[model samples]
Target: MDLLKKKILAEGSVEEGNILKVDSFLNHQLDVAFLNEVGKEFKRLFEDREITKILTLETSGIAIASIAAQYFNVPVVFAKKIATKNLDKATYESDVYSYTKGRTYKIKVSKKYITSDDRILIIDDFLANAQAALGLMDIINKAGATLEGIGIVIEKGFQDGGELLRKQGINLKSLVIVDSLEVGNIKFR
Candidate 1:
């Protein structure tokens, strides 16, 4: 994950309110090569797990999960933040409060996409407040699906998200953990 760390240092910007904007390569502008490396790392990390499907939130998590799904040979299911006509009425739902957006929103997934017998691996771009992760976990639990593990590209270690998930006995792997973002200085753990 050294390449990812280096890329973060080179292109990531610490914005106001401690938000680390990685739009240059991660969420906004796509970095296929770097993302391929990310996929490889995630596959290596969760290779031993019985992962039947990859779960993620919509928008930012879509690309990472899609690329990683290739390595796992599983379908990627993303929770939709916006309700659509195509989405089934019978869905697993959860509420997530976005610290960055400063509001709570409901995320939903069709029941047909997930089942009780499947083992799910959650993937996302970042882990900060754990709200999104917890929300996704709730959906997985509602479906009676087993959560095999969580793969995060970058974790804000200064926050309690990673610690809380770990305390809950989740097998969480973060490629690069930022211990501090004080005064716009990025400190990694």
Candidate 2:
């Protein structure tokens, strides 16, 4: 995790209101080799659990989840941020507040993907307030599936998302946790 922490300190920018913009290597353009390491770390952290599926949100979470799925040998299912015409009416839906985007949106997942028999591992690029993670967990609940764990690439420890999920007894793992981002300085937890 030191390498990842180092990458964040070097390339990540701290915007006003405690947002860490990792668009260069994560949310926008991706680094495949770095992602592979992330996948391996996730696999290692959750080795004891039986992960049948990898669940994530659309757009940003897709690439990270798909890459990690290769390590888990499980199928990746991403909840769509926008409702599409082809989507079924019987799908599970949840609304999430995105701090980075400065808006609230509904995310949906088809009911056919998750089931009672599956153990799901949620993966995403970042976790600040954890609204998206909670929304995804809600979808998993609606499908009657068990949440195996959550694998976050980067977590803002200064926020409440990680603590909130931990308080709920959900298994959460963050590769690099930012304790503070004050005046362009990155502090790790």
Candidate 3:
């Protein structure tokens, strides 16, 4: 986690709209070796929990979830933001509002991929408003799956996402938390 904090301080930038741009290594571009370490950390964090599968949202979360799944030796299931013909008609769906996109999207996952017997671990690149994480949790609930935990690469501590999850008794782990993104300064907690 310290390595992640260092990475954020070294390569992460504060963009407009309080966005912490970590695309250099965490997202956009792929860093397999570093992500492998991240995966190992997730494994270490959740080793006490039972995890049957890894679930995540589309796009940004896919890479992080996939890499982490290697450590769990589990398959990754991502909710599709956009509908596709290949996706099953029978799916668990949830609506999520994207602060960046300024709209809501219906994320879906095939019911076949998840079941009542599954113990799911949710992984993502960032956590801000908790909309996406809630949406993924909705899908897990619909499938009657047990949510083992959530692993986040970076969490904006200024936001309420972490608190909300903790209040709900969700097992959440964030490698790095940015308490503030003041211009020319980045505060971590």
Candidate 4:
């Protein structure tokens, strides 16, 4: 996690609305070596859990979930933000309000991928408002699946997401938590 913290300090930038953009190695561009370390850390964190599948949201969470799935030896199921013809009609859906985007959108997942008997581990790039994770949790509940835990790469601790999830008794693990992003300065928690 020290590596990730260092990378964030080196390349992360703070946008206008307190958004920490980590496009260099995380969200936009792919860094397999760094992501591999992330995967290893996640595996180590959730190794004792009975994880049947890895769940994530599309766009940003896809790569992290996919790489981490290799360690868990489970299929990665990503919730689609955009509705497509390939997606089944019978799907589990949840509404998520994006703090960064400033709007609410529905995220969906096919029922076939998740079942009642499976234990799910949710993975994502960031946790700020906890809306995405809450939306994914709603889908898991609809499928009657058990949520084993949540793995976050970089948690914006200045926000309430991590605290909210922890209050709900969620087993959340974050690699690097940024406690502050004031005036483009990053403070770790």
Candidate 5:
């Protein structure tokens, strides 16, 4: 976690609205070594959980979750943000509001990927409003799957997302927690 915190200080940028732009290493421009470290840490955090699958959103969450899945020995199932012609019609759906994009989207996952017997671990690059996390939880609930835990790369602790999930009794873990991101300064907790 110290390594991740250092990476944030070294490369992360503070954007307006409490956003920490970690595009250089996290959300974009891929960092294989750092991702491996993230995977190992996630494995360590959820070592005792019965993780059968790793669930994430498409695009940004895919690479992170896929890399981490190597440690969990679980299949990665990413919910698609965009609907494609080839996508299965039978799916678990949820609506998500993207504060970054300033729009709402319907995320979907094929019903075949998750089942009642599986324990799912949700992973993502960031957690701010918890909309995406909530959306994923909806899908998992629809499938009757037990949520093992949530593993976040960078969490804006100033936001209510993490606390809200914890209050709901779902196991949530974030690697790097940002306490504040204002006026080009990144503060971590």
Candidate 6:
């Protein structure tokens, strides 16, 4: 993941409130080639798992999850953050508090997309407070789908997200972790 660490140092910026903004390639504007590499890395990390589908939250997690799904050869299922007219009535849902938005969101995924027999891998652009991941995990549990692992592009190691997941026995892999976000300096773990 040296390449990912390099990309972050070169293109990432530290915003107010400990936010490591990697919008250039990882979030807002995408770099597909780089994402393909990320996908491959995730597959390599979770290669031994029996993954039947990839699950992610909407918005930022969509692109990353979609690319990773290519490597896993599974369909991507995203929880809808905003209510959509086409969403199915029968759904698995959970509430997630957004650190950036400063509010809670009810994310939902159609019941048809997840089931007891499915082995799921969760993917996302970042993991800070683990709120989104927790919500997705709730949905996975509701469907009785087994969560094989979680692949994170960037993790704020200064936060408790990764630690919490690992403590819960989650196989969490983060491409790059920002261990420190001091005013003019940045550190990685």
Candidate 5 TM-score over all chains jointly = 0.98
* Inter-residue clash pairs, candidate 4: none
Q: Mind giving the per-residue lDDT tens digits that candidate 6 earns over 103-175?
A: 9999999999999999999999999999999999999999998999999998999899999999999999999
As for lDDT, the candidate ahead, 4 or 6, is: 4
Summarize candidate 2's per-residue lDDT along 34-78 as a digit string, tens digits. 888888999999999999999999899999999899999999999
Model 1's TM-score against the true structure: 0.98
Candidate 1's residue-wise lDDT over 1-189, tens digit each? 899989988998898888999998999999999899999999999999999999999899999999999999999999999999999999999999998899998999999999999899999999998999999999999999999999999999999999999999999999999998855578999
What does candidate 4's lDDT look like per residue over 1-189, in tens digits? 899999998888988888999999999999999999899999999999999999999889999999999999999999999999989999999999988789998999999999999899999999999999999999999999999999999999989999999999999999989998976688998
Clashing pairs in 2: none
Where does candidate 5 clash, by residue pair? none
Runs of candidate 1 with Cα error greater than 4 angstroms are none
User: Which residue runs does candidate 6 get wrong by more than 4 Å?
Assistant: none
Clashing residue pairs, backbone N/CA/C < 3 A, model 1: none
Candidate 6 pairs with clashing backbones: none
Candidate 1 vs candidate 3, lDDT winner: 1
Which order, best to worst by lDDT? 1, 4, 6, 3, 5, 2
lDDT of 4: 0.95
Q: In candidate 2, how many clashes are counted?
A: 0
What ranges in model 4 sit over 4 Å off?
none
The lDDT for every candidate, in the order shown, is: 0.95, 0.92, 0.93, 0.95, 0.92, 0.93
